[model samples]
Structures are given as structure tokens and as C-alpha cells.
Target: MAQPRRRATPTKRDLLRADLRRSTPEELSHALQMLLDQSRLSRDERLHALASALVVEALAPYWVGDRTPNQAHDALCADDEELARVIEALAPMLLGHIEVREEARDAVATIEAMLGF
Candidate 1:
């Protein structure tokens, strides 16, 4: 006997996907161009962050556990060399998009200045 398959849970963008599908393909193409023009900067950042996160995940497949990534906030404390290389490679690529995040720290500064976080 075959059981009917259940529908998958919808992602946040699922409504947009559904709307696009209902639209004429030609209309959808036009809408895409308009949306891109309006939100190019946000789109660029999202793509870059997604790419960096995916690269890190792909590099450490065996590190799978039961947390929604950075959820535990402790994974960042682990010591590993390959992890170092992963971060180093991603730093320059991400600098332009995240200049504030890429700033260097000064250990000799006053407490408040040193805590520029």
C-alpha cells in the first residue's frame, strides 16, 4: 500500500514563491527585475552571508549536532586549525560587505574603548 506524501513546511519565502508561480511567467520576470532594482543592497548582503555560512558548514560536515547554528553560542569557542583557515579565507571576502564587523581590536585602549564591541 502507498501512503500519500505530506506537504513540506513552507519557508519564509514560500508565499513569494507561490505568488510568483501564479503570476504569468513573463509578468514574474518583470516583477523580479523591479524587486532587484529596489532591494539590491539587501540582496547582495544576504547572498554574501549565505555563501559564507554555507562554505563553513560544507567544510565541517562531521560537526553536526542538535542546535540551530550559533544558537548555543559555544561552538565558537572550540579550538581547531582547519576552522582557522576557514575563517581566514572568509575574512577578506566578507570585509567589503561588513566593514564594521571587520574592524580590528586594540588591547591597549581604556576599558570602554577596548570594549568597542
Candidate 2:
């Protein structure tokens, strides 16, 4: 008799990291826009938190990657204006709904510091 092996489910962070890594720049912008729209329309605290976390995850690599936050931020702004615009548009909504969730706060703070807001 053979034993069956079970696969582990991915965590939310794992899923998010994968999504960010695999997304193209345009896809990333679209995802941010969708999250921003959800944040604007949804009153649910959990949904807001999730959206905020995703936005942060998308931007974190640029802001907190190998380069300095300022350097990454500068490069992003210079190289990808559309993506930068999407981030700028989403920042205030994320900041407004930031709650006790550490991921949400860190994400919002990363964008704010990156944008000099």
C-alpha cells in the first residue's frame, strides 16, 4: 500500500508575491486600478485591508528592493509614468482606510514615502 502525499495550500502572502512577480507592468497597473476601485466602493474593512495589502505588495519591490527606496522610487517615476500615476491615484484611498493591519499600514507608508506625500 502506498501513502498519498498532500500538497500544502499557499498563504495569502505567497499568492500575493507570486501575483506581483508574474504581472507585466501594464497588468500590474490594471490590478492596482481594480484595487483602487474596490477600495473606493467597498465599505467592508477586510476587503479594504486586502486591497491595501495588494497595492503595497505591488509597489514594495520597487521601493524596498535592492536599490534605496528613494532611488527605486525615482527610477519608477522616470521610467514608468503610467504606473506611477496609478500608484499616486491609489495612495490617498489606501491611506484613508489604513487600519490596525500592519501590512496595510506598511504598504500605504511605502507609497507615501516613495511619492514624498
Candidate 3:
């Protein structure tokens, strides 16, 4: 008898990360806006924190060199106010963290410049 093949299930974090990675700049911005808007109505502190963290992760690609800073800037030019607002809210938190990886510094710097901070 042939053995049955088991399908692997992705964990929530893995799924979220993949979705963020696949999103275009506009789609990613919209997703972050939704998460931020949802976080406001939810009273769960953990949920809010998770949403914030996910937003940060979603923004990481812009800073990670896989996506150029100019691409992010161009997306910003498309008038994504929610994306701008989310970036303004999250940039400080990301910059203040002590554990940010060295590779992410350039991306972070790009974000800072974009935000005029």
C-alpha cells in the first residue's frame, strides 16, 4: 500500500509573513491600514500589539533592499494616506527597538527620510 502524503499547514505567523511578502506596495499599504483601523476598535492589548508588529514586518521589505526605497516613495506618491499614517506611527517604534538587525538599517533609514524625520 502507498503511504498517504500529509499536507503541511502553515502557522499563522508564516501565513501572515508570506502574504506581506507577496503584496504589492499598494496592497501592502491597504492591509496595514486595515490592521491599524481594526486595532483601534479592539480592546485586546495583545491583538493590538500583534497588529502593530505585523505592520512593522510588512514594512520591512521596503527597508530590506528587496524593494527599493524609490519604489516605496513612488507608492507614497499615489496618495495612500493610511499608509503614510501607519508608517508615521510605526517608524519610531521600529527605530527605538534595540534588536533590529544590521541589514535592515538602510531600509529603516529610507523610511525615516520618506517620513521627513
Who wins the lDDT comparison? Answer: 2
Clashes of 3: 1
Question: Whole-model lDDT, candidate 2?
Answer: 0.65
Clashing pairs in 2: none
The TM-score values for the models, in the order shown, are 0.27, 0.38, 0.29
Better of 1 and 2 by TM-score: 2
- Give candidate 1's total backbone clashes: 0
Q: Which candidate order results from sorting by TM-score in descending order?
A: 2, 3, 1
**How big is the RMSD of model 2?**
15.1
lDDT of each: 0.56, 0.65, 0.60
For the record, the alpha-carbon RMSD of candidate 1 to the native fold, in angstroms, is 15.2
lDDT of 3: 0.60
Residue-by-residue lDDT tens digits, candidate 3, 5-66: 64344344544664776789887765655554544454444444665676655555455656
- How close is each model in CA RMSD to the real structure? 15.2, 15.1, 16.4
